[model samples]
Target chain A: MDQFTLNLLFVGASFALYIGIAVWARAGSTAEFYAAGRGVHPVTNGMATAADWMSAASFISMAGLIAFTGFDNSSFLMGWTGGYVLLALLLAPYLRKFGKFTVSEFIGDRFYSPTARLVAVICLLVASITYVIGQMQGVGIAFGRFLEVDAFWGLLIGACVVFAYAVFGGMKGVTYTQVAQYCVLITAYTIPAIFISLQLTGTPIPALGLFSEYTPGGEPSGVYLLTKLDQIVTDLGFASYTEAHRDNLNMVLFTLSLMIGTAGLPHVIMRFFTVPRVSDARWSAGWTLVFIALLYLTAPAVGAMARLNISEMMWPNGTEGAAVSVETIETDPRYNWMLTWQKTGLLDWEDKNGDGLIQYYNDGSEALAARAAENGWEGNELTNFNRDILVLANPEIANLPGWVIGLVAAGGLAAALSTAAGLLLAISSAVSHDLVKGAIAPGISEKGELLAARISMAAAIVVAVILGLNPPGFAAQTVALAFGLAAASIFPALMMGIFSKRVNNVGAVSGMMAGLLFTLIYIFLHKGWFFIPGTNSFADTVDGSLLGIQSTAIGAIGALLNFAVAFGVSSMTAETPQEIKDLVESVRTPRGAGAAAADH
Target chain B: MDQANQTPAVDKEGRTYWKANIRLIAWSLAIWALVSFGFGILLRPLLKGIEIGGTDLGFWFAQQGSILVFLALIFFYAWRMNKLDRFYGVDEE
Candidate 1:
């Protein structure tokens, strides 16, 4: 069968499975819709949360980022995963014990002010909506490449699919579908990795293969995999693959930002509320990491191996020899992945100096540029190698079978749809449960609230699609900004609400506004106002950064500002009320947390 | 109903339980920071001599080792706290 037909079969089957699960598990009540009726097993909730947490950014872009940038990008690996530890230890169980329908609900109740809850709702919406834009764009990219449709049409179709399940199933539907998605995505991710690992290092486990010796031709038998990769890239005038190139201070702050952001994200936190007990919330976090680690552990291996393969293929006779001819790239089956990707205009090459050979090396090096000038090579021929294409093109790059490629397509879609659904749920719940029911219309009926939730979800999808059409950055970068926003605004407020009893409503609101505004302004100033491109006052380079900290790493500093402001304000103002103090004490204990309140 | 009636005793027990939980969290977070930020980034230079897979031990810790440790820490915290909850008479029936 042809590759496109196979992709259609696999993606169609996975969508059928998700829609089937949504129909079967349609939510019946407000509890069912918001919290999955608070009856999900710890392990099951863990699986669903894993699917929700690992978005298209993780599946499509992370390994590719690591592949090209090498050791400097390891911060992404550590930062994204390390945040779960904070979530499990500091946030998850306690939030579950609070037994609220939405994260903002806890903020509102704990602070004894609707204004505090409203602030939380705005923060949640901004972070989640920003986060969902990446997913929407990812869906478009995946569909555009595989199904051969325009990206806008692909986004429209994806939005309709998300609406069908999310509007009807709510959290209850999303949870089960996510469980299925986890299986599909993990399988899709691991199979190609295993094949590539075996081909490169004779090891089935990609993680261990990363450290193993490369003995492909049996001559020079014990060259370590990373050692060989570093040697190969450096030989081509690129930086050593295993050595860090970024400033240590920025790396540390970046990792810290991602950790705090992960803990603060409303979608991931909401997953914990579905579990049966507070202990289960803790255990569920562990399980979620276990599932997530299956991909995280393999990611570095995939990055290293893919880099090695691309380098070796480009320079079959070593970097000193003649480059691969353009004729071979056009006609050879091994190079066909470029043809499919080039159609999307993401991968391209130009024979700038009319050289029939393609040179894939670091043209930024002055010595190499001088050599290229002597050789009549204009510049790097591979002009637009989109980093996001690395994972999607991995199986094809490795020349794996058609079925594996099909599985990857399905996996990519699962990743985007699962996260999109989870974020949409967070956005809609904030609208109906926190905004309308909690504050605006306290006397709203159950049916009215449900309708409002559905309408809000639909509206959120439309807005996300519109924003997705013009994403300010790559999927992972945009997602990282979402994390920064969450870390600065929401995490501190949630932590203070639980950890400190002295924080008052005035303090909480002020801290959230300060953190959110500080982070947003920094990001917009560097990335453009509202990320409109070329509207930014400052560049994102090291010279343009404040104190050499990029906007992505500024969240940790923003979070500190939030804490200091909240503490300072609270110290100068009135103390927390006795009733709210009692509520905080109740949330701290795990004894009576199982029977979650159906309505506030 | 019986536990609700014994509010004063339970409140005392809850205070003890809460204190114990805070102590546990402090220890866990300290270790978390030590492994990820300390060994992975800040102290990476000091561990340059200790190499794994053509990379330093700190690099391995940054990319892979910290995640494994985080998984263990979360599970260990859960198990230890669940036991503590029962010991302090705060476990859900």
Candidate 2:
């Protein structure tokens, strides 16, 4: 079968499985819809959380980012995984013990104020809405490439699929479907890595393969994989592959932002609420990391191998050999992936200086540009190599079986759809459960609330689609901004609520506003006001950033500002109510946690 | 709504349990910081002599080692905290 047909078959099969699970596990009541009746197994919830956590960014864009940037981007790996430690130890068990359906419920009840809940809902919506935009764009990209349709139509179809499952299944449907997604995505991710790893280093394990010697073409190069990669890239005038290229301070703050943000995200935090016990919440966090690590550990290996492969393909004999002829790139079946990706406008080449060869190098480097000038090359010819295409195109680049390529297409869609559904659920629940039911219409029936949830979900999808058409950044970077927003606002409030008895309603509410607004303004100033492009006063240059920290890494500072504001305001305000203080005490201990009041 | 659920003995025990939990968290987080930020990023040059595979140990720590340690730390904390929960009579039946 043709590659497109195989892609349709695998993608169709995966969607059928998701819809089947949604139908079988249709949520019966608000309890099931919101929290899956608090009966999910720790391991099962862990798998679902992994699916919920690893969005389009993790599955599609992360390895690609790692491939090109090398060691400077290790922050993405460590930051994302290390957050589970914070979640398990500091957040998950306490929140699960508090026994509420949504994250805002805990903030609302703990602070004993509807306004605090409303503030949290706003933060949740902002973070989730931003996050879902990346997922929608990911879905569009995956569908556009595989199905040969416009990205907008692909997004509409993806939104409809998500609406069908998320509206009907709610958290319950999303939970099980996420489990299936985790399986498909993990398999799809690792199989190709294993194939590439074996092909590159003769090692079956990608992580160990990263450390193994380079033995391509059955010739013992006697150089380690990373060592050879560094040599090759630097020789070609690129930065050393394994050296730190970013400022140390910025890397620290960026890692901290991603870590805290990961812990603070409402969709990830909400998953812990579904498990049966506080202990399970802790266990599930660990399990989620194990599943996430399965992809993460292999990602660097995949990246390095693919970079080597691309470098090798460009320089057929070696880096010193003649560049691959443009004629070959245009007509060679070995370079077929380039042609397919070129149609998506994400991959393109131009023979600058009218040279009949494609020279892919860092034209930005003066030294490389000089070398290109000496070689009669005008500039870099690999004009638009989108980082998001690395993993999806890896199997094709290595000439793997058609089925492997199809599997990757399905996996990318599963990753995007699973996360989009989870974020949509978080947004809908915040609107229905926290905003409407908790404040606006406390007397609303469960059925009415369910209807409201579905409507809000559909509305959230539409908003995400509109924003996705003009995504502010790459999938992972855009997702990282969501983490920053979450870190700056919601996470600190939730943590302080659990850990402190002194923080009052006024403190939490003002703190969230201060953090949310500060981070939003900072991001808008740099990324453009409301991310509309060309509206920013200052360019995203070193001078434009505060203390040389990019807007994406500013969340840790914003979170610190939040804590300072909360403590300062709380010291002057009245103490928490006695009942609320008791509630704080109740959440810390594990007994009677399983019997959390359904709150319906 | 359930003010009657509160007892002086439970409150006293809860305070102790919470203090112990805080101590545990403090220690665990300190290690978490040490591995990821300290070894992985800040103190990486200091550990240049220690090499794993082709890369230095610190680079591996940044990318892979720290994640494994995080998993271990969380599981260890969970197991220890569960034991502490049972000891304090705070574990769910």
Candidate 3:
């Protein structure tokens, strides 16, 4: 069969499986829709959480970010996975024990303020909607590349599929569907990694293969791969792979932001509620991380190995020796991946100075200019190579099979769709549970709540799909913003609710508002309020950073501000009602396991 | 609400039970902070050269390796905490 047909078959089979699960596990009651009736197996919930957590960013963009930036870009991998540690230890079990339907509900009730809940909902909606646009873009890109269509059309098609599956399924359908999605995406991700790792380092495990010796055609078995990579990168005027030039302070903050963001995200936290007990919540989080680690561990290796392969292909004769001829770039059958990627308009090059040879360099470096003048190069010509293309192109660069490439297309879509479905569920539940029942109509019927949840879900998908069509920013780039909002607003508040008994309603509300508001303003001052580039007051630079903390790191500061404000304000106020305090104690106790307290 | 049906409570020392819970949280949070924010971020500079796999110790902690430890920590917490809860007479039916 043709490659396109095979891709369709693979992707179609996965979609069929998802729809089948949706049908089989369709949620009937509000309990099932919101919390899966608190009966999910730890292993099953773990698989679902993996799918919810991976998203388009982890599956499609993370490896690509590492592939291009080398060691300096390790922030993406570290930031994404390390957050699970925070989730597993600090957040998951407590929240599961608290036994709420949504993150906002926890905030609202714990702090005793509807405004706090509403604000949490707003943050959740904004972060989720903004984040979903990235997944939509992933779905479109994967579909566009595999199906050979415009990404916007692919996005539209993806939106329709999500609307049909996600609007009705809620958590019950989604939990089961995500199990299937986890399998598809993980299979798609590992197959190509194993193939390339075996080819490069003779190890099936990509993480270990990354550290082992290079297999550069005739090189010895123990040849250090990174040393070889560093030598080649320096020779080509690129920064050394292992050396980090970015501010250590800023890198630390960025990683912290991603960590908090990962832990605080509503879609991810909601998964714990599906499991049976507080203990299961604990076990399930570990399982989720185990599954996520499968990809996070491999991403850095893929990036390093792909970078080595691409650079070698461009040079043909080693980087220190000779450059590839212009004729070779255009005419050589070996450089075909460049042409294939170019069709996506994500990779571009122009032959400058009337020379057919395209020279790629860091024109930003002052030292490289003198070196370039001797080489008769005016500027770097390999422009417009979008960083997100790195992972998708890795398979082609490694000269993998057509079926593997087809599987990657399907895998990327599964990752994007699974996350989008989870987010939609969260948004719908928050609207139905927190906003509608908690504030708008306190006496909402179960049937009414379910109807409203579906409507909100359908609407959320529409908004996400529309934004996906004309993504206001780079695909993976907006994830930092989502994480920032999460870190700034959600993580600190949840932690405080569990750990600190002193924080009251006015305190928690004000703190959350302050954290989210300040983080948003700082991000806006740098990334532009709605992410329109020129409208921002400050640039995304170390100089422009607040106290030299990068935008990614600023969320940590917001979180600190939240904690401080909540404590400062609460200490001035009277104690919380005795019942609420008792409720907090009860959640922690796990006493009389099945107590259905109206207050709790 | 069925008030009569809900009060089939266990008679236990609530003070010692909660204190035990507190002790567990304190210990777990300490290690939790250590592995993630500690080893992955703050303490990363201290262990710069000690290598694991192909990358330095810090990078391993930040990405692949720290998560493994976290998995171990959580499951251990689950097992031990459950035992502790049962001992303190807080476990459910």
Candidate 4:
């Protein structure tokens, strides 16, 4: 079959599978809708959580980030996976035992204040909505490229599907669908890696292939893949592949921020509640990471190998040889993906000097710029190479089979839709469980609340789809904004509540305000207060940073301030009651692990 | 509002449990910080010449390798902590 037909078929099959599963696992009660009846096996829960956790960014953007930026971007990996450690060890098991429906519920109850819960609800909404924007944009781009539709129309189609899937299915529906998605995405992801690895290293497993030697025809394997990649990239004026240039201290802190932030995300934490028992929670977390690691380990190999292939393709004669002539672009079938992508307007090239040759270079680099002008170059020709294109473009570079290419398109959609479902579940639950039942009514029938949950779910999907159509920024870019908000608000409060029993309502609230205010002001100074560009006075560059810390790393500092102030203020206030201390004591134990802890 | 339903653990006999919990958290967090942020970033320079499978040790830690180690660490903590929980008569009954 033609590649286009295959793309359509693969995507159609995946969606069909998702809807089929959603129908099979349809929610039968309020309990089933919200927590899948709290009967999910540990391994099954882990698989679903993995799907929920690794969204479009993980599948589409992470390897691409490493591919382009080289070593400076390793923080994305460490920060992302490390957060699960915090979640499993510090948060998940305990929260599962607490058995609440929403994260803010825990906060409100622990701090003994509706106001605290309200603040938490706000934080959860801000982070979840902001996070969804990334997935929405991801759906649009993936749809536009694979289906040959306009980006906006593509986003609309993606939005409608997510709305249908998320609204009809709920968490019970979502849990099973995500399991299918996890299988599709992982299979799609690893297949490409394995193919490329076998061709390069003669190894079948991409994870093992990464550490193996590489043979380029007559060339020996001692020109190890990374070493060759580093030489090629640096030869082209980009940084070395294996060595990073980001500030060491800040990189460490930034990765820490991502890790801590991941643990604090309300949506991810809530996944643990789907499983039964504390030991189950513990084992489930381990299983989730195992699935996630499959992609994480292969990503670097895929990234490094793709970079080498593209560079080699760009310079057919070698790194020191002449650039590929523009004639080849139109004539060579290997360059078809680039030509096809160019029509999207997101990928473009200008001849600049009309030399009939396109040059891709870091024109901003002084050394390259000076040399380029001597060769009568006006400027680099390739423009608008959107970061999202790398993963999509990978198969084209390696010249993979049509079915494999089709799988990638489906995998991207799966990643985006699975996450959208999970987040919508979080939003709906917070609205009905936290806002309606806890704060508004104080008394509600299970049936009535189930209706409310479904209503809120429909409402949330409508809002998210509308926002997705005219999202504030790029998909991957907007995701960082979500992480920033998460780091600022939820992370601090959650950490303080767990680790410091002295953090009373007054202290926790104050710390949240301080952290939120500071992070917001800093982000606004760079990203615009509301993320509109040019409204901000300060630059977002390294020179513009406060204390030389990157904006992403600021959350860690915000968290510190939260802890210090919360502990500081709590000391002056009355200590928690003896009973409250005992509550803390009980949450610490793994015994009585099967029954939900009731708050008195 | 939340304190109403807490499973009350008798603390007078088990205050040492709190100390032990704190110690474990401190140690786990330290290793977590060290592997992820330390070997992954700040001390990467110290590992500049050291390489594994064509990449720097630090680069490996940051991207592909450290995460696997982290998984092991958490499970180990859970296993060992389960032992600790039983030692203090705190294991889930």
Restricting to chain A, the TM-score for each candidate equals 0.95, 0.96, 0.92, 0.93
Task: Using DockQ, give the best candidate's number.
Answer: 2
Residue lDDT tens for model 4, A5-83? 9999999999889877776677444445555626778777888888888888788877877888878878878888888
Cα misplacement distance, residue B41 of candidate 4 (Å): 0.8
lDDT of 2 by residue, A1-600 (tens): 899999999999998887777666773443366556267778888888898788899999899889999999998999899999989998999888887667887888898888998999999999988898878878877877897665567677777877775765454344777789899999999999999888878999999999999888767889898999998898788999899988888899889999999999987887787688888888889999999999999888888899999988888868877888889988999999988888777788998877798888877777677677778877788888888888889999999999999999999988987778767877887888888888899999999998899889988888888877777888888888888999999989999998888999999999999999999898888888767888876666566675577888888988998999999999998978887877877777777775555675
**All candidates: TM-score:** 0.95, 0.96, 0.91, 0.93
Better of 1 and 4 by lDDT: 1
Q: What is the C-alpha lDDT of each candidate?
A: 0.85, 0.85, 0.75, 0.76
Could you tell me the lDDT of residue A262 within candidate 3?
89
Clashing pairs in 4: A109-B2, A591-B92, A598-B5, A599-B4, A599-B5, A599-B6, A600-B4, A600-B5
Residue pairs with clashing backbones, model 3: A67-A303, A253-A553
Question: What is the lDDT, from 0 to 100, of the residue A19 in candidate 2?
Answer: 77
For model 3, report DockQ. 0.42
Better of 1 and 4 by TM-score: 1
Give the better candidate number (2 or 3) by DockQ.
2
TM-score of chain A of 1: 0.95
lDDT (Cα, 0-100) at B13 in candidate 1: 70
Those runs of model 1 whose alpha carbons end farther than 4 Å from true positions after fitting are A26-34, A150-153, A168-174, A217-220, A441-455, B1-6, B9-13
Better of 2 and 3 by lDDT: 2
Model 3 C-alpha RMSD vs. true structure (Å) is 3.3
